[model samples]
Target: MAVDVLNESNWAVEPRVFSDLGLWVMDQMKISTDCDLTIIFNEPDAMEELHLRWMNLEGPTDVMSFPMDELRPGDGTTDVEGMLGDIVLCPAVAATQAQSAGHSTIEELMLLTIHGCLHLLGFDHSDKDQEKEMFGIQRQLLLTYLAARPGELNEVIPLEISGE
Candidate 1:
């Protein structure tokens, strides 16, 4: 898969870190070699609009995925060089979630990036079985990535889901 990073936010996180996470997620998902992914980091206000539309919430969300179902393999619209879809992220919300979860903002942002990428690949947690499977893979991927990063220290927490 091809990965492109676009940063339009003033958040404190490093751009390289976010880009690396996007690449990491694409690798873990085993996305088709033909797929293309673009990640855009935007300010909280811009992300809030997507949060309201897709998530029905009133605040910034860490990440949101916009998958392109119209662009398929063999479609003339897909250039061998075109993107599959976009993943938008808000570093502000990621920082807050990291503070609550007791991890670095970078880690939280990476987790959200992976989650969004999975959604692009048709993974969802809208039900019990799906939630279990999706979140389980998420937690595992996050732990493995964190463990492999040099000088990174993080505590492993049990996976849990609250509310339906």
Candidate 2:
């Protein structure tokens, strides 16, 4: 999987973790290794414009996904491979949600990353059953990712982002 992270926000961004989360989501969804994905961190003003233009919502949201290739999970067929499109994330919004959730901003961002990736993979939560399945899978993925990391409790893992 080739995951590209671009940060154009005022807040501190962790590109490596975003890339890792993309890869992890792809792996869990059985996407092909040749798949390419992009995650972008942008300012609230830009996000608000996108929210209004794409979703027709009034305010800036935490994350928005624009999936390309229309890739769906494999059903006794070959796995998906191609550009997975872009995920636009607003760190400012995430920070507020993090405070409300009583967690660090990075944790909240990680959750949002997983959520965006799921949307890119054709997961929807518009209905009750869909919400249950999507949220359940999100929780499972977060737990699995956390368990696999080697770090102290509540520690924000240091990430080294190269080449911006």
Candidate 3:
């Protein structure tokens, strides 16, 4: 899997963490090694513009996904491959949400990354059942990712991934 994280925001960003999360999400979903995904971090002003333009929402949201190729999760027998879409993130907004959610900004960002990946893989939460299924998968993905990492809880680092 090819994962790239571009920081287009004013905040200092760790490109590896986001890239690592993307690779993890791809592997967990049984996506092919040839798949590519991009995650971009943006400022709230830019994010607000995107939110209004793309989603038609009024304010900046924590995350938004634009899926291309419409890739879906695959069975282990045959992994799916495509140019998975982009995940746009707002760190300033994530910080505020993290404060309310009682976690660090990085944790919130990581969760949003997984959520965005799910969206890229065609997961939706429009209804109650859909919400349950999607969110359950999200929680499971987070936990499994956490469990696989080799670090202290406070200093969790994303896995390092290179080309297969």
Which one wins on TM-score? 3
lDDT of 1 by residue, 1-164 (tens): 36778878775444556566666665555444346778888888999988998889988888899987533323333333235588898877877788899977767778888788778767889999999988998889888887888654333221222231
Models, CA RMSD each = 8.1, 3.8, 5.7
Clashing pairs in 1: none
Show where candidate 1 strays beyond 4 Å: 69-82, 152-164
137, model 2: CA deviation in Å? 0.6
User: Cα deviation of 24 in candidate 2 (Å)?
Assistant: 1.2
Error in Å for residue 62 of model 2: 0.2
- How far residue 87's Cα lies from its native spot in candidate 2, in Å, is 0.5
lDDT of 1: 0.71
- The candidate with the higher TM-score, 2 or 3, is 3
For lDDT, the strongest prediction is 3
Q: Extract clashing residue pairs from model 3.
A: none
Error of 2 at 46 (Å): 0.5
Model 1 residue 50 CA deviation (Å) reads 2.0
Give the least accurate 10-residue stretch of model 2, judged by summed lDDT. Answer: 152-161
**For candidate 3, lDDT tens digit of each residue in 6-50?**
888877667877788798889889997568899999988999999
Q: Is candidate 1 or candidate 2 better by lDDT?
A: 2
